[model samples]
Target: MKNNPHHPYHPIIYVRGFAATQSEIEAAVADPYMGFNIGSTKTRLAWTGQVKRFHFESPLVRLMGEHGYRDVFVDGNDLVAGDFADQPIPYQSIIVYRYYDEASNDFGSGETPPIEHFARGLNKLILRLQDKVCANKRNNVSPEDFRVHLVAHSMGGLVCRAFLQNKGLGTEKARAAVDKLFTYATPHNGIDMRIVRNVPGWLSFGDANNFNRERMANYLDLPKGDDVSIVKHFPPERVFNLIGTNSRDYSVLRGASSWAAGDASDGLVRIENATTHGPGADGRDVTSPRAFVHRSHSGHYGIVNSEEGYQNLTRFLFGKLRIDGILDIDNITFPAELDKYHEENRAVRASYQIESAVSVRKYPWQITRREIRENSAIFRTYDQLFPGQPGTKRPPDRSMSPHLFSVFLDPEKSCKASKSVSLLCDLKLLTPDYEVDGVLFLKRHYEGGVIYQRQILVEAIPDTNAAGGWRIKYGDQENNPGKATLVAESRPLGDGDPASGLVFSIPIQQKSRPGLHGALRVEVRPWS
Candidate 1:
C-alpha cells in the first residue's frame, strides 16, 4: 500500500530471532533497536586466492544512508517528549518490536511471551505506528494506505508470519497493511536437527514447541493436515526468504548447534526448510522467492550481518526489476563407453549439480552465488530422466524443474540511469554421478568427467512497465558482447504458471563431450 515517491518507503519493523536463555533474552531487550544496530567487518576471498576486507555498516545504517531513514533516538529523549509536536517523521522509519523487553530484568516479571502474543503485539505495533505517522501532516499517508515491511532474522521470521497468517492470533487488517516481508535464515518449516530431523512432537519446553512442525502448523493456521503450504493470508511472492548454506561458520552455541544442523544449512536452519511455503498455483507445495547464500545462521558470518543478505534486502525492498532463473535441459550425453550400456537397456543413474551465480548490472556484490565448493549446489536429479522401460517415468525437466535463483535490480542506482540492466551469470553443471556398465559411480567415486560451465548474459528491461520481460544475448567473451545472437527469449513470472519462472537458454559445450546437444534452459520470475 505504501507505493509511489510521495510515500515511497515503508517503515521497517525488525523482529529478531529466538533467544532461549535468560541472559540472551536480557541482552536482546536492553538494546532499543535490538541487534538491528549491529555492524560487522569481514573478509571477501577473491578468485585469485587473495582476501579483502569489507565492512557492512549494518542494515539500519544502510537504510538511513541510502533511503533517508532516521532512528527514533534523538537528543537524550524520545520524540513524544515535545508534547506530540514534531514534523511527522518520514514514512521511512526503523522500529524494533521490543517483544523481548517483557523478558528483560528491567521490564515485566522477566518472562517471554508466546509467539501468538508476539503476533498480537505486531498487530498493535502496526496500528500504533500508523496512528503516530498519520498524526504528522507532511507524511500525508491515509489511514488505510499506511504499510510496513518486516525484516526479521532466525525465529523472528516465525513471529512475523504468525502476525500475518495466523487468523486467531493476528488481525486481517494488520496483515493487509504489510507491503512485503523479508527473512534471513528463517526455518519456515520447523528446524530439523541432523539426528532428530524435524523437531520432536514432545519437545515443548518453553518456546521449543515453536519449532515443532505440527505445533507450527497449528499455530500458523496452515491448512489442517497439510504441513507444507504457503498460508493464504498473503501473496506467496511478497515474502522473500534468504537461506544460509554455510553451516560450519556459525559460531553460536560453541559450534554444537551448527554441527547438529549438519550440511545444506546456515548452521541453524537447513536450506530446504528456510522459506515460506504453500501450494502454488501449479499445485506444487512450492516455497516463495528464496535464494541461497554462503553464510551461517547468526554471528559474523551470519545471514543478517553479511553483504549478501544486505544486498538482497535493499534490492528486494527498493529494486525496480526482478528476475527468476530456471535451468532448462534439452539433452544429456554420456561418455562413449558409458553410452554403450545405455543402448543395452540397462539401468544408469545420474544427477546434476546445477550451479549458478548471478550479479546485478553494476553492484560489486553478487546477489545469488552457489557453487559446489561452497556446499551450495542446486541438485536437479533423475533416477532416469531418460529411461528404457515402459513403466519408468521421466518427467519433463522444464515444466517442473526448480528455479536456480532470482536477481532483483534497482536499475537507476545499480545501472546508473540505464533503461536496460545487464547481469553476468556463471552457470556450471557438475557430473555429480554417472552409471557405467550397470555400475553407479558417484561424483566422489569417479576421477574425471565432463564438467560444463558457461557464461550467460541477461539484459532485463529496467522498467516494470516495459513491454517485454527480457532479451537474451549469448556469446563467448572472445567475441563481441553486442553481436551475440539471442538464443531464447524471457518472460515475466506472472505471465506463465505460478510455479513456472523466467526462461532462458545456454548452449552446453565441452572438449570431452563436444557433441552434447543441450542448452541450460533457465527461467526467472519477478519476485515481490
Candidate 2:
C-alpha cells in the first residue's frame, strides 16, 4: 500500500571520512552514527568578529525530521546484525557503513584494514540491505528498484568511488544499487600539502599513505598518469561534489593541517582537488555537478554539519530541477595602447579571472561562491584563452571555457509558493594586468579592477504545457533590481525532450576597450 522504494527518497548510506590515528579510529567506532549526527550551535560572522548562535541539527537529524528517513539501529542493535531476514524496514533509511569497526580494539584486531576491504564490506552491506528492503510485503519494491544514495565526506567519497570503479572490490549488483553520490570536501585528486606537494606514498604512519596518489591509484584501479578525479565505471553527473572554501576555521592539529594544506582549501582538502570529472556520453571528460561553500573541513564549522551543505545535499537528492552555468567566450578586446604593442609584435600577455556567487531568491547563504578575495575564482591565461594570437599558432580552445556553477533546485522550495524559481548569479570578470616585452606594463593599470560585473537574476517558470516545459526570463540585477524582464529563448539540448530541459544564452559583453565578450550559457534540466 505504501511506496517503499521512493524514486528520489532512496535509502542513504552514510560513509564517514578517515580517522587518522588509532585513538581517532577508536573514537570513530564508539560513535553510533560515525560523526554524521554531530551538529553545531554557533557560527562566526565573516565580515565582523562576532559569534552568532545558529543551531544546525546536523544532516542526520535534519533528514529524520524533514524527510521520513529512519536509522537502521533498533533496540541498541543495528538491523544488519539483527535477525531481520523477514522483517522489512522503511525504504528511506540511513545506514552507516561502520568500516572503522574492524580497526577498533573494541571490535576487531585494532589494526586498520585497507580501503579495498572497506569497499568490499560496503558491497556486502548493500546486498544485505537489498534483501531486507525487498522483504517488505506491503511495499512494492523489487530487487532492481531497490536503490541507495551514498552521502560521504572527505576520504569516504574515495571509498564510494572505489566500490563503483574497482570491479574486484564490489559486485555488479551492489554497484547498480547505488543511485547517486554526494561528497563533502573530498580530495578526489589526493591530498597535497603546501611543502610536500603530494602526500608521500611511504608515509604509512596511521595509514597516512592512504591519501597518497599512488596508493589511491592502485586501490581505485586508476591507470598510470591518469587524473585521479576521473570516474570510469559510474555516471559522474549523478555525483555531486560539495567543496569547502573556508580554511581559517579548520583548527585541526592546532591549525597545522590547515597550514600544511595552505590557502584555497577547506582546512584539509584543496578546493581545486575536491571535485571530480569523468568521461561524458560523447567520450569527452566532463566535470561533475559541484558547489562551493564557506565551510571548514571538520569542526564546529565543518562542511558536513553546516546549513549550506545540508541544503545542497537535500536539493541534489530530491530536487526537481538542475541548472548549470558556463561562460563561453567569443572574443576579448584589448585597449588601443595594448593593441598597438601587440601590433608591433613585442609580445603581450594578460590573464583573466572570473568570479561568481550563486544563491536562491530567498536563501541567505550562497549555494556556490568563487571570488578574487577567496582565491577561488576561475583563472585563465591569455595564451589559454586567445591562443594563436600573438605568441602561439594554435587556435582558441572552446573546451577551456570555465564552468561557473551547477546548482540543484527543488520546485517545492520555490519562494512564497510561487510557481517559478529565482536564481541570482553575481558575476564579475576581473581585468588582467598587461606585460609587454616581458616587462610590467603598468601605464594605466590598477589593482582589483573589474572589466564587467553584474548580478543576473534568472526566473524559471516550469510549465508542463509549455513548448520546452519551462519559461525562462532573466534581467541584469544591477539595472533592474529583483526582476527578470528579458524572456530567454528556449534552445533545447540533445534530443529536445522537455525532461532534457533547455539552454538559455545571456550575452555578456563590455563595449569599452580592455573588455570581455562572452555568453553565459545556462542549462536547465529535470533532476530526480
Candidate 3:
C-alpha cells in the first residue's frame, strides 16, 4: 500500500476470460471457431501481465493514487490454481478470479460463463480476502475494518449480480461485503449482439445435446429440466453497469453473422448488450432516466479504450454528474449594441438547420452562433394564462408568453459577473418538446448539471412561518441548538432558453404562496 491510512478502500479485481483446462485452452487457441479465440489460460495470462503494466504500473496506479486510494495488490485471474501461494500478497489487495476453469469444460458457450457459478467462486474468494484482512487487524497491522468495492469489466457484472442476488448472504451481509460494484460493458440480459444468425434460433440451441449453446444453458442451469442455470438466481441491487461503445470496428468475427447489423458495437458487444437490467430496475425502460451513452460501434472488445468510452466510464465511476437537459438560448449575451450575425444560419427559417447542426455535434458550441437582428423575435406563441394573482383574481383563461431563459457555461468566469459565464448544452436537448428543454446551460457556481425539481435540506432557526427569510440554524440543529449559522441554498431554474446553446434561459415558476416574499430555496447533492 502507499501508506495512506485515510485512503478509501477501492481495490479493483479484474477477472480474465475462459479458464477451461490445458488441452481445452490449446484447442480453443489453435482452432478457428470464431474471430480470435485465445482460450482461458492464455487470456488470463495475458490479462495478468497487462494488468501489471497498464493498470498496476504507471497510468492507472497514478490515477487511483490521485483519487486517494493506495496501490492494492493485483492477482492474476488463476489465483485459485495455487497461484496465490506463489505470488506474494501485498497490503490492500484485489483478487481476480477466472470465470472459466480450463480443467472444467463447464463454460459451454464461447462467451463468459453463467453468473451464478462465477459468483459462488468469487464470493468464496472474497470471504477469504476478508478473513485475511481481519487477521491483519488482529495481528496489530490495522486499527479498523473496511469494505471491498468491486470494479468488474464485461461479463464480470453478471458475477456481481449473482453475488448480490445470493440472498443467503442476507441483506445486511450482502451490503456489508460489497459496498460498490462497477461493471464496464456487462450484458445483464445476455446481450443481443446480433452475432448469432438469429436470436430465437440461437436460444433454440438450448436443446441440442453436445452443442456449445446447450452446454452453456446446462451450465447456467436455466429452467432446462434438471440442468443448471446458475444466473437465474442472483439478486439485483448491488451492481452498476458501465456501458461503452466506440465508432471503430475491432470485432471482426468472420463466418458468424454481423452482430451489430449496421449499428455500432464495441467490437465484441453491442452498446445495448453492455447494459444491465433486472428486478432492481423497477419499471424504467432501456432509455429512461437517460444514463448510458451510445458511441461508435467499434466492436465489443476494444470499447473500453475509446475516448468517449473512457470519458463516460470515468465520469460514471468517479464524477457525480448528469446531463439533465439541453440549454435552449433565447437571448445571446452578445456585447450590448454589437452587430449580431445575420447569416442565413440565423434567420427564423434556419430552425431546421439549427436542429440538424445540433444533432450531429457532441460539443454544443460547434453549432454556429447567429447574430441577433434588431426587432427580430425568435418565435411567437399564444400567451398561456397562469393562476392569476391571489387576491386580484382574473378570469381562468388568462395567459401570457414569457421569454425563455437559456443557460450557459462560462469557463472564463473570474467570479466578477454571471454574464461572463458560458453554458453546456447537449445536442439531444435541442429537441423542442422534451421535458428537459432549455436545460442546456448549467449554473457554474454549483459544479453540476441543473435539474427541474429539488428537495430542500436546512434547519430552521427561530422557526416561524410569518418570517420572510430563513435564518441558518447550523450544527446540532437536528436536536437542540446553540450552533453557528451556515446558509445552504439552490434552485432548479428550468431551461432558460428555447433555442439550444451553452447559455440557457431559465423560466420562472409561479411565485411562492401569494404573500410569501422570500424565494423558495432548494439544496441537493448529486449521487456519484
In terms of TM-score, the best-performing candidate is: 2
- Measured with C-alpha atoms, the lDDT of residue 338 in candidate 3 is 17
What tens digits encode model 1's per-residue C-alpha lDDT throughout 1-528? Answer: 433344437888888998888888888877777888788898778677899887999889888998888765566444421345564556788888888877778876777778889889888888877788778777777878888889999888888888788788867777887888899988888788878878787876657778888778776887544254355677777789898889888887798888888877888887778877665666666557777788888887778887789889987887766666666555566666556665676665667776788766546777887877777877765543343462354445455454777667765664444466667777777765776545775534544343676677766543444334445555554355523456464444544653334556665554464133456555545443
Model 2 global lDDT (CA atoms, 0 to 1): 0.87
lDDT of each: 0.72, 0.87, 0.34
Q: What is the TM-score (0 to 1) of candidate 2?
A: 0.95
| lDDT for position 478 in model 3 | 37
What is the per-residue lDDT of model 3 for residues 166-263, given as tens digits with 9 covering 90 to 100?
55422434335554565655544443434442133244331212223233343333444322212323332234444433324444446132344324
How many steric overlaps does candidate 3 have? 72
Residue 286 accuracy (lDDT) in model 2: 73
CA lDDT, candidate 2, residue 401 = 82
> What's each prediction's clash count?
12, 0, 72
- Of 1 and 3, the candidate ranking higher by TM-score: 1
The runs of at least 3 residues in candidate 3 whose Cα sits more than 4 Å from the true structure, single-residue gaps closed, are: 1-7, 16-92, 102-114, 138-145, 168-175, 193-239, 255-264, 277-301, 306-423, 428-528
- The best candidate in terms of lDDT: 2
Off by over 4 Å in 1: 2-4, 45-52, 75-87, 223-226, 279-286, 384-395, 414-418, 436-438, 441-450, 461-466, 469-474, 478-528
